[model samples]
Target: AQTVTQSQPEMSVQEAETVTLSCTYDTSENNYYLFWYKQPPSRQMILVIRQEAYKQQNATENRFSVNFQKAAKSFSLKISDSQLGDTAMYFCSEAGYRNSGNTPLVFGKGTRLSVIA
Candidate 1:
């Protein structure tokens, strides 16, 4: 079984500050993928960043990046230069079980991030 866990239920940051959201997962497969998704109030799923197991470099996009520790089974999201628009529910998910993509993403409960201006 592959399980992704985000221990923090909620987090906050002042405008322009930086915040890191924690995530951990349990998986037996050596080659897999991980993703961080942002869901704003509008309820749309936005891809923040994705890390491929084979890549030694962590994935990054604009202000969002991930600290992927494969051996530790930990993947964390780091947000720099946080803005009001960054407020949203972030979910960490694993993709690459034999039936992973065929089924819906098994998501962590989520971490609601609020960026205060």
Candidate 2:
């Protein structure tokens, strides 16, 4: 079984500043995927970035980067040059491959981020 945990329930950052959201997971499966998702007021789950458990390097997408510590089972998201548009609910997820198909993602209680101007 796998579970994702986001320690911060909410956070606020000034515009153009940087913010890091911490996420940790527990899983018995060796092969799995870690993900960060951002949900805006529109209620859409957007994929911020993804990290494979086997990968040694971290994953980055534009201003969004992940600090993936495989041994520690930690995958934290760093939002650089944060913008007001970045304000949203961020969720950390874990999904393990199954013999039948891909397992449903186990999501953490989202951390609400507010990029204040």
Candidate 3:
């Protein structure tokens, strides 16, 4: 059984500050991908960052990055220079066995983040 967990239900950060969201997962499979997605008020899910289990270097995109600790099966998202636009519900997911084509993404409950001025 594989499961993703976001211990933090909600978080707040001041504008221009940095915030880190934690996520942990349980999986026996060695090959998989971890992801962080952001859903705004509109409910459109946006990819924040992705980390391949095989990759030792963490993945980063602009102001978003992931701290992927494979051994501990933990993947965390870090948002830098936080802006009001970043206020959204962030979900952590795990996709396994890409070749199978039936591997559904198992997602965490999600963490709602607010940016305070």
Candidate 4:
């Protein structure tokens, strides 16, 4: 079984500033994928970044980056130069293989991020 946890329920950052959202997971599988997704007010799930359990390097996408600590089972997202568009609900998820097929992603409750001007 795999589970994702986001300790912060809500967070706010000033515009053009930086913010980091924390996530931790517990999975028995040796190989899995960790992800950070952003859902705006329009309710679209957007992939922020993804990290593979086997990869030693962290994943980055534009202004978004992840600090992946495999041993600690921690994956945190850092949003740089935060903008109004960054305000959304962020979810941490994990996916593992099952019987040669990818299992459905298990997601955290989500953290609401507000980029205040």
lDDT ranking, high to low: 2, 4, 3, 1
- What local lDDT score does residue 107 receive in model 4, on the 0 to 100 scale? 99
For residues 1-117, what per-residue lDDT tens digits would candidate 2 score against the true structure? 788999999999999999999999999876899999999999999999999989899999999999999889899999999999999999999998868788889999999999999
Clashing pairs in 1: none
For every model shown, the clashing-pair count is 0, 0, 0, 0
> lDDT score of model 2?
0.95
Tens digits of lDDT, candidate 1, 80-101:
9999999999999987745544
Deviating ranges (above 4 Å) for candidate 4:
none
What is the per-residue lDDT of model 3 for residues 19-106, given as tens digits with 9 covering 90 to 100?
9999999986668889999999999999888888999999999999999998898999999999999999999999887566747789
What's model 4's TM-score? 0.96
Name the weakest run of 10 consecutive residues (lDDT summed) in model 3.
95-104
lDDT of each: 0.89, 0.95, 0.93, 0.94
- Misplaced by over 4 Å in model 3 are none
Residue 17's lDDT within candidate 1 is: 100
Report the C-alpha displacement of residue 30, candidate 3, in angstroms: 2.5
TM-score per candidate, chains pooled = 0.92, 0.96, 0.96, 0.96
Candidate 4: Cα lDDT at 83: 96
